[model samples]
Target: MPSKPLTTYVTHQPMTAVQVLEKAAEIVAERYFHGDVFCSAKATKDFLTFKMGGYEREVFAVMLLDSQHSMIEFRELFFGSIDAASVYPREVVKVGLEVNAAAIILAHNHPSGVPEPSQSDKRITSQLKDALALVDIRVLDHIVVGETCVSFAERGLI
Candidate 1:
């Protein structure tokens, strides 16, 4: 028997961690594109859950949307400790203006994996809603992501 040299093939580029995440986020965003109204609470929750569910600390993010509810951008605005984050409405409003977003879906992960909105969550949602309303921006939903996502809009909190 004759010895044969091993053969190998490289069909795709090896992606970095960040590149992989970016590609995944792009795919998630694509699911919301083919619609007149991008206001499906379940879909929004599902999408956000995939994006924010695996954090060890808290991450506050927003899905900025145009007037017709199409995506303008998805941004992680604040990073915090395992249990708490100081979410600034001014900064959020600034990004909304910068992106020219007409509405936003707020999300944050509970690293503890409970997915329950605490008192602070309720308070901030109210504050953010009122603050954004001042600038003619709408807060469509706030999703608390953990093992599962809990939606404020679905519960009539938004």
Candidate 2:
């Protein structure tokens, strides 16, 4: 038999590590979050941890939800240095309005591997809650992702 060219054997390009992880996250989100009712803090924490835990820098994300608490969207809205991500209430509200979200769950990753909510986190959560309230959008919880996930609501902070 004649030797075939290598090009004929390659059907697709390989995925980078990041691409693989992104695809995996998408699969998990579709299976676990999309159109699913909010049931427990542990579930939320697990999802957020999976989504945000691997970042080397800070990322602020929002889980926009419907009136029935089904997920509308999960968006990473802000990026920052290894230590902090600037979260803007107005921008968050704009995203919420764009999605017509009835509620939101906030989440961020700490590159420092600490899951404790900082004072700044508390302040921004308050600001976001107030801003979202103006449009009748509820702020359900704020989660900090690090070595583990911490729920602000669980700590009576929300």
Candidate 3:
């Protein structure tokens, strides 16, 4: 007698709205955060917005990239209150060095619906750019995610 071919079965479990959102975010990150897939400013903005847009407080993060500009990791380095987060250049540089990142895209979220880069934001970006420069890591852009996303590179702030 001939044996029947076996078939694999799969099941789909129902997920809540938050769980679905989280799963979608995970899929987006997996697709965009690897290889040179983050090739456009719009793509980067979308990824950063998804990652930081829902926060109630300030969150400072970096997208560590390899020499080929592929993402190495997305790290949230600092957390703070509604308006401010203490970003340390030394720590940022350290993380870049530790991961051997050749470039970085900085990101932070404003709790208010405003995406404008404040004077403080500008100053920190400048500081972080200068600090990362010493280690030969490029500062690609500084993105402020709020109601919309703002790119420092587009504004020529980087």
C-alpha lDDT values of all predictions: 0.86, 0.89, 0.90
Of candidates 2 and 1, the better by TM-score? 2
Give each prediction's root-mean-square deviation over alpha carbons: 5.3, 3.2, 5.1
| Backbone clash count, each prediction separately | 0, 0, 0
Candidate 3 residue lDDT tens string, 1-158: 99999999999889866565567667787776666776788778888776788889999999999998988888999999999999999999999999999999999999896999999999999999999999999999999999999999999888
Model 3, global lDDT: 0.90
Return the top candidate by lDDT.
Answer: 3
Q: Which stretches of candidate 1 lie over 4 Å from their true place?
A: 1-22
Q: Which stretches of candidate 3 lie over 4 Å from their true place?
A: 1-21
Instruction: State candidate 1's TM-score.
Output: 0.84
- lDDT rank, highest first? 3, 2, 1
For all predicted structures, in order, the TM-scores are 0.84, 0.87, 0.85
Summarize candidate 1's per-residue lDDT along 1-158 as a digit string, tens digits.
Answer: 99999899869979866566567666777866546546577667767776777678999999899988888888999999999988999999999999899999899999999999999999999999999999999998999999888999889988
Q: Candidate 2 residues 1-38, lDDT tens each? A: 99987665657889876676678767766676645447
Residue pairs of candidate 2 with colliding backbone atoms: none
Better structure of 2 and 3 per lDDT: 3
What residue pairs are clashing in model 3? none
